[model samples]
Target: MARILIVDDAKFMRMTLTNILTKANHVVVGEGENGKEAIRLFRELDPDIVTMDITMPEMSGLDAVKEIRNEFSDAKIIMCSAMGQQKMVVEAIEAGAKDFIVKPFDENRVIDAINRVLG
Candidate 1:
């Protein structure tokens, strides 16, 4: 398992994701309530992977992805998107995100994305 950072505007979403990852034997290094904090935590915490939500206060996840990619080119990022955001998902991949997970996450899907990206 790798060190993971969970970034989402919703407290409940962050908490839920944190619990899930932690239970699955991954070390959840930090959690971010917004993209700004997410970017700051990324540098401060230096986690092995990141799960970043699409919509949030201040910077959007897409902006954060670009910023993170600019500095940490080798960063492993998993964009968290909602269904029907196909274009945005494609943009995220173009911005260097490793993979993505859909909203209202399925445990198995999340794990699979993480595993595939990590490998």
Candidate 2:
């Protein structure tokens, strides 16, 4: 039941995330197509959690994670990536991501990641 923000470039990915999180009873506070908007909305909305895409236009999720963590050290962020982004995933974890989820996401995995991050 945490407030969550989803940041991803692809429309269908966003939609899939929204549906999955919504169905699990999490309030999706906002969705963004790029890291700049994601950062802006994260500050404005102050969600409990954020799911960030590793690759996106404008700003990369790694950069956004850095920026957000720069301001909000206590921020709860989950990095989402396609398989095989080991280096990026490691960087994101170092940048303060609570967890990472592999895409073409599974509903159960998504929910589990959310719960683990929130905890």
Candidate 3:
């Protein structure tokens, strides 16, 4: 099981991901509300992977992915985007996120992403 850090502005989104990950037997190391917290949590937790929301108050997930990957080149990140955020999702991938999950997440897709990234 991988240790995961979930960063999202919506509490429900974070909780949803937490449930999905936990049910899949993955340990959630931490949860954050924005990109800034994502960076800090990455430093402190050093989780196996991170699920980052694309937009937030302080910093964007794209920026966070860039920052984290700069420091930890092998940092594994998965961008989470809402429908129609395709452009941002592509940019996130370019920023070094390993994979992505669309909003109103699919359980199988989420698990598949984690497995693929962790694998």
Candidate 4:
């Protein structure tokens, strides 16, 4: 099981991801509502993986990914984006995200992404 940090602006999204990840036997070590919180929690929790939303208040997940990667080059991050956000998803990958999941998430895809990144 991997330690995970989930970051999203929507409370429901966070809860949903927590359920899926926990059901898959991954420990949700922390949660954040924005990129700023994501960065802070990452440093504090040092989780094995992070699921980050691209559009968020305070800071963008792409920026958070860059910041986290700067500090921890090997940090494993997976971006969560809405459909039609291909540009942002590409940017996220360039910024250091290991993978991405499109929202309205599928539980199987989420689990597969986490496993692939961790694998």
lDDT of 4 at 66: 96
Best candidate per lDDT, number? Answer: 4
* Global lDDT of model 3: 0.96
lDDT of 4 by residue, 51-119 (tens): 999999999999999999999999999999999999999999999999999999999999999999999
Across 42-75, the per-residue lDDT of candidate 3 in tens digits comes to 9999999999999998999989999999999999
TM-score of 3: 0.98
Clashing pairs in 3: none
Identify the runs in model 3 with alpha carbons over 4 angstroms from their true place.
none
Measured with C-alpha atoms, the lDDT of residue 50 in candidate 2 is 94
- In the range 23-116, model 1's lDDT, one tens digit per residue, is 8899999989788998999999999999999889999998999999999999999999888998988998999999999988888889898899
The residue-by-residue lDDT of candidate 2 on 1-116, one tens digit each, is 99999999999999999999989998988999889988999999999999999999999999999999999999999999999998999999999999999999999999999988
The superposed Cα distance between candidate 3 and the true structure at residue 68, in angstroms, equals 0.5
User: lDDT per model, in order?
Assistant: 0.91, 0.94, 0.96, 0.97
Return the lDDT, model 4, position 105: 98
Residue 102, candidate 1: C-alpha displacement in angstroms: 0.6
The global Cα lDDT (0 to 1) of model 4 is: 0.97
Q: CA lDDT of 56 in candidate 3?
A: 94
The whole-model C-alpha lDDT of candidate 2 against the native structure comes to: 0.94
